[model samples]
Target: VGGAWFAGDCAALSECYSAGSQYSAAPILPDPLVLPTVQHLRESWDDYQDAVEDDPEVGEDGFIFDFAPDELHKANISGATHEIEMVQYVADPVIHGVTGRSGITLVEYLRVSISWGGMPGWSFKPDQAPAALAALRVRPDF
Candidate 1:
């Protein structure tokens, strides 16, 4: 994974790294994945929200989470640099037929999640709620 240089309360870190091989000469893929399980996603979201709404020391994007090495190997493929934000919903997916288990499944699957703490502090003010709401307008026609 490439390094992430962060500023203020928001920071993006190198979750993992992978290198492509030429022909048959190749090296083991580095940091195969940045898989944050569903539980991890929930916890990270809760923590980031709490940091924004409660923790004074928590600067913008101050909360950082990464993938466990084994989880990365198991889930991450192609050595792609997956931002934690992009895979936070992996936690909502089921881990059946992979964990040596059966008949277990999870719901509410997604690919990415926005972090509350990543927002600039000024944007979270009471007076900005209306404008913020307006800016969130999503046009499905596109």
Candidate 2:
């Protein structure tokens, strides 16, 4: 149920979504959850591309050398069932092993399941989720 999506050669809306799910296993959520998740990813990708386009410093290769986490969009969705949450964030290329260039911004989407009764509750460490999730890279079409 966990995987990474890379938008390596995605350059269009359809391509972007295709790439987003290419590396991941088939989603288990119903359409209600899946549709919105896709929308969020698409919007985030668009925002990232817009930021890159607006940056005067972007190189001919379409990479922003001075990228920052805040420059990328941040969003979250709480499932209707209230048992899952999806989070999207900008991932650091160096940490994620996406590319050698520090300016290449990668986005990561994570699906976390909530548990109500346990010492740790969640399967993954909340504090360390960012680092762990950031390692998952999605290559959005630019």
Candidate 3:
């Protein structure tokens, strides 16, 4: 009866927005239970770029790197939903293989970068300190 009311209204609005879709499968309803804070994949990209510059093989421009789709997981956040557990940033470059050749060896290349941020469950309410620190695991989408 509490947050569920808000969740229901949100669901209704979402359905209304999604009216008369030509798609076969129903659009996934956004989960009401899980909430998110200020997060973005762009930051991850930037960090990756920085790491690449540090590598001798990657050169100044980052034209050689490839990005993968972001992945999400549960990532324990015990106290507040907005709280971040831990965020790990990774970027890698992949090298392609060519067809048959003589004795020459042509190898593909890859560059990887990683960074982390945020603490989970840090109660803004001042009381739940221990639980917050204990929840210091990586965030799902990091």
Q: Best candidate per lDDT, number? A: 1
- Candidate number with the higher TM-score (2 or 3): 2
lDDT of 1 by residue, 1-142 (tens): 2322211111132122233122122122111112346677677668777877876667454444542322123223322222232223455434322222233232211111112121222122324333433343332321
Judging by TM-score against the true structure, name the best candidate. 1
What are the C-alpha RMSDs, in order, of all predicted structures?
19.9, 16.5, 20.1
TM-score of each: 0.25, 0.22, 0.19
TM-score, prediction 2:
0.22
* lDDT (Cα atoms) of all candidates against the true structure: 0.31, 0.26, 0.25
Residue 127 lDDT in candidate 3: 44
lDDT for position 3 in model 3: 13
Error of 2 at 8 (Å): 35
